[model samples]
Target: MSRIDYSVWDHIEVSDDEDATHPNVNTASLFRWRHQARVERTEAFRKKGAELEEALAESKHELTRAHEKAGELAAGSSKARDDIERLKREEREWEEKVAAHRREEKKTPWNADTLCRGGFSKIAVINDVKTESVGEETETFMSFEKRYEKDVKRFAAMRSWDDSEEYLSDNPHLLCAETFNLLMMMCVDLEVLKKRESLEQTAHQAVVMRFISRLAKALKVDPRACFRRFFSKMKAADQRQLDTFADELECFKEEVRSAAKSPAWKAMDEAQRELEKEEERLEVFESLPEEMQRCFDRKDVRMLQEVIGRMEPAEARAHMKRCVKAGFWVPGAKVDGGDDDGGSDKEEDDA
Candidate 1:
């Protein structure tokens, strides 16, 4: 006969079931308070786990950089030797930190909510085509969109963490850097077009996507594997972290707005930068005094000089500054005093 196992019931936290309290005390309210406190404690523990993971990731990144730098130095150099020793010591320290954290995590008792959380043994197998690794695929924006656009839209439509989590769990391949980048661009595009409601929903999706990315980076795992953990954390009454995500969304929207109002804030190629610069110059030209604008419009250097000659010194200086900025005035034309052709040539060149 197989042995009956009863240890599975260990550490079961039943907030509603306990010995009766004093008659004057409200049992229901007390149970609610206890549940709240337990949730808060769990949330705090989750936050600490995230923080520790981040620190470990940073430490590993730093150690990798140190090794790369050390490899570039002379093998026998004193500095290289010192760095090697230092790196070894730092590596041991971080390993110890990680080991201690793992121990602590193991010591934490499972409550009713977490008792049946996902584990390797709990994963179900499905007979489906194998999904290609992202690293193996060259996914351009168009290809990524063509493949996952419908899934992304469906995800963006979800407003609840539980729903979003379930959707992503069904479609794990959508959890990737490419999807995050595309979603961010969509949010920015929506903001640019003043689609407030759509932008809000898209921005929400973008923030959640970013959280999954961060979780993956912290744990050194694929983002698709991190989505469940991220959603689980969000569902654990972690209101502060949710508020943080909301703040991130607001900041991202603000950045998009700022970039739309001023293209210089966004990175661009040389041609795009030149185009933006010309557009900016045209705006300045429009703001110039009417006489100055007309002079430039007519390509009349003589008229422009006459207009400047009539203005107060301070006003003329300001107008001249705008003219130079607008590519209408070249300070050093490299022309003979009486050569109109040379001046006109310089004006054409500047324009």
Candidate 2:
């Protein structure tokens, strides 16, 4: 069994309650019966999941062989078209079978022991590309996206379980990101050819990855590792539970898109600095002694002098110093340091 990371429980909304028993029945026996029933249901779901997987595998194998056989038929052969259609039908049937099992299995509560021992974990951003690794200068997110063309193509062309598994096992680092992108691209490619069945399968894989990455981010876990955890939880989810995950994924994706465009997180410069300075000046202006404030407001030089004279010399000087620096008011409306009322009637201090 995989290690149970209770952290996944952080944001979940599931309840665990003891069984309700009739007054005539022993509560302990009722509880035991409920526990056994849950165990049996979980085991059935696990067996069904395994069977669905096996059936899907067999269906895909048949579809592959059908494609090869169809290619050997003449271009205008109705039999070849018929063969292809049959394989496509089988594929859809298998997909539906797995989905139906997933829906049913979801009603049962999670059995930690039944969780897959395998899956993806983290989301990592390669920070500083060394000369030895990338063989180039460091690249931004946009630059890396531009360089991903061939890598995307190679991933999209994956046709078999062995090839895909081997490729992913070897390039586990890129599986969560590049693999997902390539899957979506493959869906588009298939859609262009009017291959809706194949397109659906490809898109499903892409959605699974996208959801896994989102879940990993929420739990602060690695996307690659959490991918399996997601599957484990999902495997036991009924339709309602599955729909909840789908809805949350859609909302989260929309939130990210909206936030990416807004400038709320970016820094500001000149206007912001000026605003801050003005606020600081206002704070200083409010801190002055009441008598000094009246001197500033009335621009009364004689009254200001009277106020200063009443205080300790150093204290009065410090008050005046703050007033001057904040441009609250100058000592006088005058040319000299001591402006008589006769000097200039008005002086404007520039902040």
RMSD of each: 15.6, 22.4
Instruction: Give per-residue CA lDDT, model 2, range 157-242, as digits (tens).
Output: 55543454455455556555655655644554454456866654455546666665766664556776545555655666656437
Distance from true position, residue 243, model 2, in Å? 28
Distance (Å) between predicted and true CA of 314, model 2?
1.5
TM-score for each predicted model, relative to the true structure: 0.41, 0.29
Residue-by-residue lDDT tens digits, candidate 1, 1-351: 869976656656664546579989998898778878888998997767766676566456555755666677867778877766776787678778778877887667777667776567566578887777765564566588888988998888899988998888898888887787778767766766789999889888888988788778778778876688777767886775566566567767876677656665344434555987899898888888899889888977777767766877667777676667677666666434655544334443444
Model 1 accuracy (lDDT, Cα): 0.73
Cα error of candidate 2 at position 300, Å: 2.7
Q: Which predicted model would earn the best lDDT?
A: 1
Regions more than 4 Å wrong, model 2:
1-33, 36-101, 106-269, 329-351
Candidate 2 lDDT (Cα, 0 to 1): 0.59
